[model samples]
Target: MSAALLAALTATTPAAAAPPHWTIAPSAGGGSRPAAQDGRPYIYAEGAPGSVLEDKVAVTNPSAEPLTVAVRGAGAPDVRTKAKGPGAWLTFATRSVKIPARTRAEIPFTVTVPAGATPGDHPGAIVASGGGRTSGISVHLRVSGPTLSALTVEHVRVEGGDRIAYEVVNRGNTTLTPRLAVRADGLFGGVLDKGPRTLPVELPPGRRVRLTEPWHGAPALDAVDVKVTVTAGGGAGDSATATARFVPWGPLGGALAVLAGGAFAAYASVRRRRRKGPGPGTGNPRSAP
Candidate 1:
């Protein structure tokens, strides 16, 4: 029922060569921010679903002329889009403010997470609009909930030196620490059986990471099928398979040459024996005697 106050990390709107000393930062204290908060250039908050977190965004104008800034809240912007993601959840105290030259104005705001929000990170921002230019600080909100680990291994291929390459995708709504195991089978049986090896990764939801596994000593000549299996602590599991063929061309070629030479020698011996048989009445010695 009660809204708890959060001390914000601080950031200042970059001073342009033009005007409006507009600097935006989170309120650190009564009038001054603590040194710890000074290192934080952005606003970071943690809360559960349906919880309201309150903070302030300070706007300072040190320009010689009075500045009237229009405040607006926008969702966090992404590389593919600006003003995207859960920005509507933010509410500001005042929509607009007129600040005298060389003065700073602090605008209070509250961010309320929806009850149905997924347990993960949601980005947003508080913007001050003036002279067609808008600047603000980033807010990162982490919603706490049940942690689920889901992972998938894909696009598996064997590179040089028995190195296995594959991609891991996180399909669930939680961050996962994943480990990988590699197994390869040849015409006879298992050629490469690599035990489960822990990978250095913290995969977040909806992200795919490419990783590789080293199979130190692979069979020289074999038609092998390789599989990569990924698993995490919270029951996350997935596997992908691929095939590769390895041959020792030098050894194979030498074996073929030796067989050909032996066949030629046997054929010559048979022809010589047939030509000499009963050629010159050699077996009719009785008539000549």
Candidate 2:
């Protein structure tokens, strides 16, 4: 064979390749539930230890060959995990589980937050690995314990008339029933009125409710200081205070009217003096007689 022919044949032939192309992607399925993806998944439950929280994890097969994935638990000592059928059941230590590729399966996992685990938030992550590819995802767990009801007055503003509208928000994850108390103070820092009013509201986590306090005898006040205190379910221990400005339109208008009248009177008096003939015959000294 000629050297050119041999070189051409060798170049035309295909070379040995590496392993099959494999990739991992997160997904969610089952019922109307929303799945976590892009490195974050949200799991919600209200129970004691050994309680299972079921969630779906998705695995995709982009390669020509089928791949088997392993879903595993990772993170802090208070969490655990195990595979539940196509998915995984995470116990106290189970944070994550895996699913197979090319078939796209949903894995169910249970999170058993140990007893006495801080009533606030416990953070952990679940990892899925297969076909020489691996990715880790985080799980947000909120533990519930004794109800610590708290209330916060997020915003306060005075509208038309003697009405004061306030926005109260419950920053805690639990529901809260709030009772609000509002006090109006003059610019000199003197309390104008104080009363006990019940503002019933069942606000969920990160929710806000508006309350209006109409002062039946609020004297016309312009730019007065206001202080608001909120108590959850009449609990004094969990209260919040906020201060704002209260401007009354009626008083402001009256002040503006008085200023305008003064300006008008001054202008009219100057015009009348100019029109009168320089004090009863005191004519312009520069004019010809």
Candidate 3:
């Protein structure tokens, strides 16, 4: 062969093989898990607003020899690793992970939910590159808002006169303006007290408040029922019901006399019934009377 032709052929020819080697399995991580072979892998997380999620990556060495895997890019400033020494989110930590022949290792990356974080879905990935070879995996994450709120009314009681008091609370993230409705029945007859009274209050994130309403006119007798409703922006609203005992007022002496008379009447009625007992029973008397 000519010298020039031989040089060109050598340059174009492929290099000789060294030894038998193991081949990496395609889709070894089942397409769901992220795997790092020659280079870095990427993953994703999804969370709600003010929520957190985590993504993981695995490195596998298919060869017969032990493989030393060094993890990096987690602490990088531009990287979004939610790790902190204390009270931090989206954190990641890993030492030199050694995967023995036909073995694998794991590395985790966490994504923290941010306070006042906007509501939406976010996408991120972890790049795992090493050993002169590279591979990438993707991460998916989502964030959402407050689902619902629980409201309760407790200890509703009527004071000395016709005054009523109860408690109102907002167990939600958003502020609330509760509309209260009072209804009383039983001895006082059916009556409805409806008002669009604004509470003139702002409840911020996990707070409670006490409310009192007074009823004029005749004192309530027997049981009194109160129904309360709460409404707020974003079409968030709730309702609750509470009951109180209403006491009637009268002259002290007169009230005492009435109670005594009622008790005496009840006792007399019981005695009369006992005396008239077994009237129609045909039984053997002690001595035929």
lDDT of each: 0.72, 0.52, 0.50
Residue 18 miss distance in model 2 (angstroms): 72
- Flag regions of model 3 displaced more than 4 Å: 1-150, 218-220, 252-255, 258-289
Candidate 1 lDDT by residue in tens digits, 1-289: 0011111222233565554546667766422233273545667767788888777777788878788887766653322223245567778788888888888888887877777677766556666678445666666667788766677888999998468899998877655778888889999999888788787876656667888887888899889999889998779999889999998888999999999999999999999999878666566456465
Q: Please, what are the lDDT tens digits per residue for candidate 2 over residues 144-205?
A: 66544555775676666467778876555444556666777666666556565666554544
Task: Give per-candidate clash totals.
Answer: 3, 15, 32
Two-way TM-score contest, 1 vs 2, winner = 1
Q: Considering only N, C-alpha and C atoms within 3 Å, which residue pairs clash in candidate 1?
A: 13-23, 13-24, 75-87
lDDT of 1: 0.72
Please identify model 2 stretches exceeding 4 Å from their true place. Answer: 1-46, 49-148, 187-192, 233-289
User: Which runs of model 1 end up more than 4 angstroms from their true locations?
Assistant: 1-52, 55-83, 86-140, 144-147, 187-191, 253-289
lDDT of 3: 0.50
Best by lDDT: 1
RMSD of each: 9.0, 17.1, 23.3
Question: What order do candidates take by lDDT, descending?
Answer: 1, 2, 3
Query: Which candidate, 1 or 3, has the higher lDDT?
Result: 1
